[model samples]
Target: MTLSNPADGRDDPYLWLEEIDGERAVAWVDAQNTRTDGFLVDESYQRDFDAVLKILDADDRIPFVGKSGDYLYNFWKDAEHPRGLWRRTTLESYRKDKPDWDVLLDIDALNKAEGISWAFAGAARSPDKTRALVSLSFNGTDAIEVREFDIATKSFVTDGFVIPKAKTQVSWVDDNTLLVGSAQTPDDSTEAGYTRTVKRWTRGTPLTAAETVFEVEKQDVAAWFGVNRRPGHEGLMFWRALDFTRSQIFVERKHGPHAGQRLQLELPEEISVGAEASDLLISPKQDWTVGDLTIPAGGLAVIDLASFLSGARDFDIVFKPTPERALQSWAETRHGIVLELLDNVRGRLSLLRRSEAGWRETPLPGLPDNATISAQNFGGEDDPKLGEDVLFTITGFTRPTTTALWNGRSAPEKLKSAPRNFDPEGIEVQQRHAVAEDGTKIPYFLIGKNLSMATAPRPTILYGYGGFEVSLTPSYMAIAGKLWLEHGHAYAIANIRGGGEFGPSWHLASRKNTKHVAHDDFAAVARDLANSGVTTATKLACHGGSNGGLLVGNMLTRYPNLFGAIWCSVPLLDMARYTKLLAGQSWIAEYGDPEIPDEWAYLQKFSPYHLAKAGQNYPPILITTNRTDDRVHPGHARKMVARLQELGCPAWFNETVAGGHSGAVDNSKQAQSQALGYAFLRRTIAK
Candidate 1:
């Protein structure tokens, strides 16, 4: 299975597959796809695809929306509109079951008119909400073109602001001015292919004439500029210097003694900032010493912007985390702030407001226990000067998502509810903790038919994404419910370390040199499941994607006998050369720099590509990726599968021609991919 380049004298073989779009590389991809389809695209797989597609393309799915002036805008995709449509409805109308929506832009129509495959990226509206800068991507790639559209006229503004295709960021400063983050020249990008400079572009001027207002080191991940248009805080510009978890925040003074000066906020690099009226809210990822006081990591603090600018070191603590609790997220509303807290991986919603005495907390209602609840500033959270309306969503393994709107004074009104795609009758969800190798109690959610301990073990799929501080919360899985659970299968979601389930410390516990802690934690969950008789090793499967892909890949190589099947999607397998591929360089803060000899020594131990050896029995694996994924290179999946095949191991690789890192452009495509994946798992673990 070893490959090497004799001409270059390098041991690593199959690097040619990294060519991506090269004719030879594409030919190789086609051959692999044909081979995989021969086995996976069977009659059962097609039936699953049809059933999943019906659920995905159903019109009953909830269309999430955000407030913009008098409208609640939403982007919708279904069987009829594959490319989707950016439409809006008045708040009053949106409150009704069948809202009268106004179609602002049709992506399919635009693609047809332009004779190109254009996916709607996003849109940023002007301060007055009369115009917007719409971003359109080709085949869902990161690179996009932004064009100005007049909201009132419902047409593209002729001779208006437009930026050509590139990985660009656009924020409207005013009706005629925009703050743009993009390449000034063809080479003006970071090693990770992100914009390193931001410019202020005005109407009726060429992009070259745009003034450079902010710039960062080319080695940094990216730089972005945004203007806070929250009432009294209008015209306040905030600039961020981003480099993975480390970042610097700067604010442009619009008033006071330092008017027109860009002042760097005195805060730790590992802190995230947000504006709450006239105050600056900070969430620190590391312990910060301010004057004589020490703010623990994962603590939320706030200081008046005026006082902070005037050399005040005193900060009011909004919320502090305990050993098992951490701040999940926070949003500012007109009357106060809403904090989403996770206590031992369970959700708790709280409201904070500035009182004459100090900051006060009030528990918000309407969320169920043992479920995941997420909240956002609904009507006034966007403006910070208007209303106190907030929108929140609640879901769990057995419960379908229910979105509601709350105004802090009344009971939250249900705005929409996702139709039951799968029957949950007799289904049960249990939260259990598995002791990790390091003695850390890892929390996981197990879902299946209600059964007693005397019942026999059932087929199961254990899922995990144990990196990037991403929390694995409870959510209804429609496809799993219909395709797997309905057929008497169980599902488990592992909330392992290197996740924000507990707090920053939980994530830091498994990052960098200790990255293997996450893999060990995942394996611990699998072992617990098997030992408890919920599922046995022979009937169990493992699934993950992106960083999670790396998780299951480790299981495939390091613990091949632990599971019957492995479903790795859009994975990073070639750790040795990951930094040199696509945006891999940006994640050195989390995964450690592979180029460093000391770091590579530890990384190589868990690197699936390097760890996979010949003459060793491995579990059935299905590795999937998208050809147009500009983030994680598809070559990682391609090379891993090819190497496994060379080792005489049974492996399947599916690379879609379109779609980005997500690997699906439309509902149909998404359903087909899921159908293929679930089918593989079923066939591999069949009794």
Candidate 2:
């Protein structure tokens, strides 16, 4: 069988069905940095049983990308190796007395070796460098635990922490206080939903004294107790909320009875919100949007909460107007916030930081190669070509991660993840709509090497995450291009409802009782592709991680035959006991509260754990999660697999020792995991 590029405009689509599955698995990487290679992708690089835990710790410093600058910050802790979990300083709260720098949080600590138990997935010191929040999974009944740490004291308060019936969410309002947003847990309640809210906590209060700040009243934030992985925890939980639609800044009154209290902070209908809190720039226009919506997400503007929410009207709009560019980073230097933008998506270094008074744009440094980039892994890449600048893997459709950097200079690199084996000389990536049964035009990204009937039914894979308000964007991905498309595969990214693709509203469309919309959107895409003659169900596969994993699990139950194989990673399938599982108690906001009889009635209808039929003939499923997954309990997978097996369902389940929500502690280990995933995909679909 001869495989040709399908997008040559010949309308040829059906090509891969006749081709042998294992002969090769086609993967097309979008340009270079448009997609990223998730986990490690090497198959034969398997670690020995003893070496498994050791290898996962290799990529410890997988850096984070800083705003407005090229600097990346990454952290790694290895208990097996000499670089023990405690890299250096002693935490003040962990100290027996008022912390002295010399006094170790556990000077003669018993659990010192397993201290950093999990990845840096928990809270850390805020920009003020005053305090930090770290969550860890403990053995026995201690499913997961949170620590209110004091950076100044190098100690952490072990008590007074909130422990959910399942999981607890901590957002620091300031060094002295933090908010624990958790779903209500009932004596008879059961459902691993990301609904509900509140669980107010403070340092001196007894753990039992934690109070409820506010319950989300369950609207669609899709953030289940911070279940899904998205962006740095640095400030996601800002002390305030904004009128995302009208660009109205709703500030929590720092005075009065509500002094320093975290508020729901609703926004007017015409404001828009940038994904990040720092990027929550308010524009002057009453209505604006990114490219699709008509809200207040224009270039950038500054807003004050006291003026809007309090009706003070004390400030005007032009406090600081962002230039005609994306404000990539902002710095609170001696003068004011230094707004930096990378005007040219292709260049290394930023054009300049235009001062409020039109200051000269300072040149960012350059891109660093081999930079371990992630939403959280900040720091520089490993490449010298990028000198000392912040590194980014930038490319799309055809380009790869080109290196650049910023050493306090201006040059920065936009190219981060570039491809090596496959060439994107003629591939194409386009955005299209997959209309839902309810008349909603859900957007999805389609990528193919040759997309016509002559290239018809080419092997395809679709990915999604419709639960959390997490908007799927293009980033550098190397392995997908290498195996899935570069070899002649077509893939789709469904940006369905239950996601923040269009701000909070999009997610609301499919959260809680409306979660069916997410599954429907996924099925609709698969059906669209099959009916449109792009690919048939036999040649298609579906994948999702975290909440998206739940997407896959739900798909199998409702639309059993839509996919050939399902790769559900770190998924929460058992909704009933989820809130009752390790850390499961935290995510009531996204799913729903099962404690209340009415919420439980609705929750039971959609809860996968309760709804999984006994004799259903579901498709083959491959599930993965971290054993030390303090975020989404591994028990979700354990119980799920056990139930499936007992009920005579074909299930493949694997649990990594650590890596928070995701698995494969390091790149080498990550590669092995990827290889295993690829192998599983091939076994079910390609084979």
* Cα displacement (Å) at residue 185, model 2: 17
In candidate 1, which residue pairs get closer than 3 Å at backbone N, Cα or C atoms, i.e. clash? Answer: none
- Superposition error at 523 for model 2 (Å): 0.6
Q: How does candidate 2 score on lDDT? A: 0.50
Worst 10 residues of 2 by lDDT: 25-34
Clashes of each: 0, 135
CA shift of 305, model 1, Å: 1.0
List residue ranges in candidate 2 displaced over 4 A. Answer: 1-73, 76-311, 314-399, 402-426
CA lDDT of each prediction against the hidden true structure: 0.85, 0.50
lDDT tens digits, residues 1-687, model 1?
A: 222212121566888888899898899899988988888898999999999989888888888899977888999998889989999999889878889999999998988889999888989878778999999888988889999999888889999999998989888877888888886464568877888888888889999888988878878888876686665665455545566888888887565565677788888988878865677888899899999978889999888887897899899888989998889899887658889998777888998998899999888865787788999877563464746788889987778889998887889988999889888877878888899977888889888887544567889999999898899887878889999888778999999999988888888988889999999999999999999889899899999999999999999999988998999999998888888888888888888777677787778877898889998889999999998898999989998998999999989999997888875667777987899998888778855
For all predicted structures, in order, the TM-scores are 0.97, 0.58
The local lDDT score (0 to 100) that residue 417 gets in candidate 2 is: 27
Question: How well is each residue in 450-563 modelled by candidate 2, as lDDT tens digits?
Answer: 663366576678899887666665544456665567667788888788865554456667767888788899899888888877778877889998888888888877888877
